[model samples]
Target: MSTPTSSSSSSIWVLSNIKLQFFARIRRFLQSKATRKRCEPSDRFDTAKNKTEPDNKVENFETVQVTEKHKEKEEEEEEEESVIMMQRTVKMLHFGSWEEKEVAVKEIEKLAKEDVKVRKLITELGVVPVLVSMAVSPVNSRRQAGLTALIHLADGTYTNKALIVEAGILSKLPNTIDLVDESTTSKLAELLLSLSSLANTQFPLASLDFLPLLRNILETGSRSFDTKQCCLGALYNLSTVLENAGPLVSSGVVPFLLEVSSVKEVSEKALATLGNLSVTLMGKKAMENSSMVPERFIEILSWEDKPKCQELSVYILMILAHQSSLQRKKMAEAGIVHVLLEVVLLGSPLAQKRAMKLLQWFKDERQTRVGPHSGPQTPRFAMGSPVNQIEAKEGKKLMKSLVKQSLHRNMEIITQRANAAGESSKLKSLIISTSSKSLPY
Candidate 1:
């Protein structure tokens, strides 16, 4: 080792030479292997493997195309079957026996539910008039079939629904809601619910025709709970149109709805319908005339679980009480102030808001009726009408007597219904303390 650097450089060059020789031998071996055309089993297998590898992507794409075509053909066949079925159904519905018509409509009902496009197609085939004709049939089975199919077809499109109505399907409804079975009543109610949407459309439907049927269902007890709800839904839909309110009130729909409003299961829809009705003059008068007006409504405000019902009850009360001294007097006489006090403390935010608003109304109403200095006043301001304290001490005693009697009666009403909101003591204290300024709101 003459020098350490020289020895290391020579060793590195020898290692590089060994690596190059190793790669050159591997290259020579691969070239020889490819050049040999020997018909060995391994050579045949390798060639076959190379040929198969490129087709995988093409095969996957071809498979997708085949699947798409198969789906299209299946759809075409289903459409063809539906067309043939509809054609046969039309023929049977028109010319066949009632039995045949029943079977045919059942098929129509099935097909209509499957596809709305098919529903439109079926109606265009004049099946609507035929179904409408079937709906008028006296045969119960035949009638239900037609109505069931019409309900589905009405669901098809807006035009189809209008056609169903224009064909006078409503007039064909049983004059009374009672049918041979609950099923018929249920289906008919459902059909009415579906058709009631037409009340607001530009299309002129006989809105009055919907009233008697809905009212009968609501009035009847044999009808199932669900069926009555359907009629209420239909009635509610009809009430949305301003013009329908007059017929609704005249049809005596208010009292039964007032009855239903007390039922918690169906209370909200019933309340909403009443709310709609209350805005109209006829509707409001009808409600105010009912004995259930503020009393039934006042009880509803105590419902801690049904906040919406509470709110609606309060809203309807507000409508009745607005500038209505008689109605406000009735509410005060019904012990509403106690219920309202409970709501102010325990009701939902929205309910609390409405309750507070109502309280203000009653407060103002009370103040106006009996101003702070107006009741049992000793001094007289000769300008205004004088029922002052000094002018009438006997009147002062009378006022005190009336107030005591009222507090006693209100306490009884509040106490009886006071299981949950039973802290009438708080309400009692407020009422007794505030008697001079305002007895209660």
Candidate 2:
């Protein structure tokens, strides 16, 4: 009786081991199939077995099998969830269709009110493409939402900037830079600032190429205030990414910036960009490429409508002073002294003081140029050489005319400042001092 029981127990053990091995092999096969299809192993296994295995098979194990209808239902639910999430994300963008400017405005207002939501969505889903689309949309709400989103994005943060780049959002920059709508243009600038705030960390070479598109935007001049401001900020940030961008700075980008610098309200930003650029060799080289930089700068100093432009111009010139004494003389020759006087005349005593100090620098020994020879009589190239003499006279006359125009403009500015004396008395006094010093007694 003992022998018969032992033999029976051994047979049972063998059968159990074989069953376990067969199931293990089946599990491995199912796992492989699931991996190939990118499906869940447990789910796919149950799915495959239910379709192939018969319900009437011998009751050998307790494995659960899922139905095909149940699997389809789960997939549909997942897809529906994804769609809802996308819709919510798009809503955060706030840009309405082209015919709906008012709706766009309202959406943007709502988005601004939902700053925390905007931040979260952007950081989580990288809604850069959505924001860019709003910028491209003709509706005011779209533009406003894009701008506000950017403002929220650029509050000196790192992760927000990373989201912008990761979304390949900069690729859309060329289109935004080319946009002509005022609201769209302004939002584009904000986008630039947001991208720039990313700095060396997130924005690398792949992202840095967008700088040239910005150069194009500034060159185009259809840009609004916000647009130009944002371009300036991006450019300032780009200056920090110098090595990979040597050609961009050298390729007339600086001249475009100098042109923008002549604008009154945005000139300070442009000057700041230039100042940032000067730190890089490529940027200094770019300045050399701008045939009219020194001259353009001088012209900025002379713009009567904007005293701040003049002040900023002077500050930038002063910074460039450390570059080379030759640079100072070159700027002086380009009419910087006269421009400073013009600024002083339009400003208060404090402005005047700043202008006078700059003017004094122009009069510095290093900045002063000695003619080939000096005498009360016009220096002749050589005796009986009328050709050189005539040319020399013409050149001198031109210089004198420029200086005279500058001096005359400065005097006029001083007169205006004196008349206003409205927060500009200091500027008025400085103008008077500079005009007096510039004119021959």
Candidate 3:
């Protein structure tokens, strides 16, 4: 009995100790679960924050692309609008009333100035013909507006120039140019000048029957200064066409040009046209037949106002003097030798050179005529006597003085060339020696 009681007590004590250890383990596990639950929210918050930043960046990138697309769309719309406006303006130019046409033309001129597309569009719409009609309108204001519009259109575009020419504008130019009013003629001349610039248009212009009208206005002296200038400019431009050279000379262009060559405003252009006309054989013959004399050209050479005019006048004279003893003798009588000497002393370098060449030509020709071996000879009166020897001696003295002057002038130019050549030779030698020393050999 005592052994059984002892075993039962031992069992009871072991069960209590086992229950206490189980409770302690359960408390520790609960504490760990609570700590993990608390930390989970903070960790998830950090992950969500990181994901939101990239999402924001991606959204911003998409927004930028969308903005660019919108900008492009807006620009395209504006360009389309501008094209539509231009097309509308071009249409209005055709069917509009006089007042409406005037308004439309004014607008057309403005648009034409801003863009080449507008000019091409106006031309394609056949507005140039209408403009030409209005250019000759009975109403002065309408006529002026039409001319002004045409001028702007032909300002820089060859297409517009061609369109204007093709619209029968050249056919009407003669009649319109004959208008008695100074203002009318001025504008007409301006248009003629513009049309004459193109190679293809030049023939049509030359074929016109208005050369007499142009000459009349230029010579009449009744036209305003500006009108005369415009007419002069048109003639100058027309004279550039070689085919027109004959008609220009026949229409009295040479005499009028000579008459106006003294006017400072027109002198340069007048001389230039005469110079161009003299290039053609036909033109030279016509000029020689005209009332204008060679003495006028010699006088021009002496003018101190314009050096270029003097230079060009000398050049034209040089061209005329070739192969024409009559012209040469006339020039010599006009004191051309003295004038050339003055040029060599005081004119521009180019003028000086030309003058010297011409002088040398004269000298050579004199030597050829007199026979190179024959020294200066005495002139005989009707009888081969010494009565005219004094006259002959004076002529010889004059000839010697001219030769001496020419030699002195040529020596100065030759010395300059020699010095320049010597310097260049020294420079070349220095360069060669320097290069030679730099080479390995």
* Candidate with maximal TM-score: 1
Model 2 misplaced stretches (Cα beyond 4 Å):
1-113, 121-157, 171-187, 200-206, 240-248, 319-329, 338-357, 366-413, 422-441
Query: lDDT of each structure?
Result: 0.74, 0.59, 0.69
| TM-score for all models, in order of appearance | 0.71, 0.52, 0.66
lDDT for 185 (candidate 2): 61
- Shift of residue 25 alpha carbon in model 2, Å: 38
- The TM-score of candidate 1 is 0.71
Shift in Å, residue 346, candidate 3: 1.3
Instruction: Name the lDDT of candidate 1.
Output: 0.74
Location of the lowest summed lDDT over 10 successive residues in candidate 1: 371-380
Model 1 Cα lDDT, one tens digit per residue, 282-316: 99999889988888999899888899999899989
Output the lDDT of residue 17, model 1.
65
Report clashes for each candidate as comma-separated counts: 3, 10, 0
Model 3 segments more than 4 A misplaced? 1-81, 174-183, 200-206, 220-229, 364-366, 369-398, 401-441
Candidate 2 scores a C-alpha RMSD against the true structure in Å of 19.9
Whole-model lDDT, model 2: 0.59
TM-score of candidate 2 against the unseen true structure:
0.52
Instruction: Encode model 3's per-residue lDDT on 149-249: one tens digit a residue.
Output: 89888888877887887777666654324444666677777777777676445335535466676787787776777777777777887887788887888
lDDT of 2 at 136: 44
